[model samples]
Target chain A: EAGVAQSPRYKIIEKRQSVAFWCNPISGHATLYWYQQILGQGPKLLIQFQNNGVVDDSQLPKDRFSAERLKGVDSTLKIQPAKLEDSAVYLCASRRTSGSSYNEQFFGPGTRLTVL
Target chain B: GQQVMQIPQYQHVQEGEDFTTYCNSSTTLSNIQWYKQRPGGHPVFLIQLVKSGEVKKQKRLTFQFGEAKKNSSLHITATQTTDVGTYFCAGARGWGKLQFGAGTQVVVTP
Candidate 1:
């Protein structure tokens, strides 16, 4: 089976500019997630999607961040008017919804976003 | 707000030495999951423990969930260079959302 895939392995943008990260989950997986991993810190959940509907996004910055998972197979996370502090890795992960292996998540290589 | 903390923020040991990292939570947890992330790599799931006082092992790695369900530990025996990375313990207060510890970074020197 193929793993979760992410695009544009690396990105660089200036402050106040807009940036978007994309994620393609493993086939047959029903749950997808977006996380932000700052240097020296563990990945923090930014949003979670079960099928097409959002499950949790309490930590998401509504004013500057938005995400969507149209068709429920792929997802995109956008950060507009970015800030210097947003210069961290954006990780995408997916997991099975049924059967015995439900909670183990498979992660993508992640997109390294450097906000100048 | 809930928090998960990990200790021995960092550890450096020679090959063949044993290493252990602990994770603690302020409140009872429904489950705990472990992940290992190599430098410049994304986190990969190692294992998950849901029952209290459960002990599971994978090769040289041992994982234990405390009886209180608020603490956990990961112990690596006779560490190898392949063990270099950050080990994170994430606790779930409910379902879906996970609170991850800061992680314990391990450096193995030969």
Candidate 2:
């Protein structure tokens, strides 16, 4: 089976510039998530989407960051006026909705964003 | 809001030695999941513990959940070079959302 796919494995942008990251979840998966992993730290949940509807986004900075999963299969995370503190790897993950026993999340390669 | 914390931010072990990492959550969790991320790689699921005081093993790796369901531990025996990576513990209260710990970075030396 194919895994979650993401584009532009690496990205670099100047401060105050805008950047966007794309993610395509595993086929048939109904839940998608976006996380930010800073250096030497674990991935922080940014937003979650259950079939195109947001489940949680309390930690997201609405002033600068936004994400959407229009059709429930793919997602996009955007950051405007990027700050130097925003330099981190953005990871996308997906999970199936059927089984309740094991909630294993499959993660994508991630997009490494470097804001200069 | 819930928070998860990991101890020994970094661990350096001999190739043949054994070591353990710990995870604790401010709130009781319905389940806890562990994942491993190699250097420069994404996190991969390792195991999950749902039942309180449950213990599971995968080869030389042992996972244990506290009786209170608020903490977890990952013990690796006879560490090998392949074990070099960061181990993260994620705690979920309900479902679909996970609060991740800072993670313990492990380095094995020959």
Candidate 3:
């Protein structure tokens, strides 16, 4: 089975510029998530989507970051006026909502954003 | 809000030695999952413990959940070069909300 897929494995942008990352989760997966992983730290959940609806986004910085999953299959995360502190890897993950093996998450390669 | 914490931010172990990493959570978890991320790679799921005081093994890796369900541990036996990576523990208070720990970076030397 194919795993989660993401685009632009690496990206570079200037401070104050806008950047967007894309994610295509595994087929038939019902839950999708976006995470920001800073250097030397574990992934921090940015937002979570449950079939086109947001499940949680309390940690997301609404002033600068936004994400959407229109069809519940693919998702896009955008950051406007990117800051140097936003330089980190953005990871996408998916999980099966039901069944015996629902807890395991499949992660994508991630998009490394470097804001100069 | 829930928080998960890991100890020994970094560990350097001999190739044949055994080492253990720990995960602690501020709130009791319904389940705890472990993942491994190689340098420059994405995290891959290793295992998950759901029941309190549960222990599971995958080859040389042993995973244990504390009786209180507030902590977990990953013990690797006879560490190998292949074990070089960061191990992360994510605890979920509810079903689908996962709070991840900072992770323990392990380096094995020959």
Order of candidate numbers by DockQ, starting with the best: 2, 3, 1
Clash number for every model? 0, 0, 0
Regions of candidate 2 where Cα sits further than 4 Å from its true position: A100-102
* Tens-digit lDDT string for candidate 3 (B1-110): 78899998999999999999999999989999999999999999999899999999999999999999999999999999999999999998775878899999999999
Q: Each candidate's lDDT (Cα)?
A: 0.94, 0.96, 0.96
Which digits, one per residue and each the tens of the lDDT, describe model 2 over residues B28-94?
Answer: 9999999999999999999999999999999999999999999999999999999999999999887
For residue A110, model 1's alpha carbon misses the true position, in angstroms, by: 0.5
Tell me how far the alpha carbon of residue B5 in candidate 1 is from the true structure, in angstroms, after superposition.
0.5
Badly placed stretches (over 4 Å) of model 3 are none
Best by DockQ: 2
Candidate 3, A34-62: lDDT as tens digits? 99999999999999999999999999999
Candidate 3 residue pairs in clash (backbone atoms < 3 Å): none
DockQ scores for all predicted structures: 0.85, 0.93, 0.92
RMSD (CA, Å), each prediction? 0.8, 0.9, 0.6
TM-scores, all candidates, are 0.98, 0.98, 0.99
Pairs that clash in candidate 2:
none
After TM-score superposition, the amount by which residue B20's alpha carbon in candidate 2 deviates from its true location, in angstroms, is 0.6
